[model samples]
Target: MCFVLYAGTSMPIPQKEWRNDVPGLSVEALTERESPIAVHFSKPEVRYIGSTSGCGCDFPHVMFQNGDWPWFDDGEHDPEQEASDRYNREALVNLLQATGEQTVELYGVWDGDFMTPPAVREEIALTVIVDPSFRFREQGLYVVRVA
Candidate 1:
């Protein structure tokens, strides 16, 4: 399963609540079958979608393509993960600032068997808080945090 994370307005609304308000937008609460990222957050605001769905396009592909997720083959000390961690933290901080929300809810879109061959499964974990102070923490295997 491929997981995509998004920083959304901190409104805890049920998935069905979007049926009439969002039109074509598909929203469902995280379930047992949810992706690892979704399960990590365990928030009612989180939603899951098919990998092939256009929802995956919500995030800018250029962000990831621009070395956001990088790898080094030299076997020497690799900083790619650190770079990615910083990117994630900055991205979320910008999101919170843009939304002017004290706390922004993190959303995970899991695209499981619904994606094609070119798309490989991915997992990401992020927790953010803006009240009192600003902080972003990655909760999955790839742990990265900023406060």
Candidate 2:
């Protein structure tokens, strides 16, 4: 869905509340289902599309990419598993900033099927993730509304 953004207002996704909303996906399912990113590939972080609120096309707005999954290694080999690094908002911002990336794309994956969504400006993603004002509603998720 396409939604226009106004006054730079954006909001972060609340991790805890989102988790409760998805009763079917267990913690393990979420963790195991995380999309893989090639480390040496050297590009902006790609995350799973969990859920989106408001408009999906809004610029500089935060989107629900994934749920709260514990970071761990199952000792199994998926090849890309070791290269795919899922950084928190802070680290992710720094990582993308260093690369000078201008945008990020959110994609959906269900039962091994994949769908590519529109791209959000890299600036907006970084801005909301680090903003402190929206931290009140950020239960592990980072976001903001610029109105």
Model 2, 1-147: lDDT tens digits are 432211111122222222434321111112343333211112333332222222212112333346422334466665432222222234334433543334432222222222222222222345664443222111122222222
Candidate 2: which stretches are off by over 4 Å?
A: 1-87, 106-111, 116-125, 132-147
lDDT (Cα, tens digit) per residue for candidate 1, span 1-147: 345443333454334322433323244455564434433342335444211223433322211234233433465543664443444445344433544434444443334421212222233233432231222221112221222
RMSD of each: 11.4, 17.0
The TM-score measured for candidate 2 stands at: 0.26
Top model number, TM-score: 1
**Sliding window of 10 residues with minimal summed lDDT for model 1:** 135-144
Distance from true location, Cα of 10 in model 2, Å: 25
Clash totals in order: 1, 10
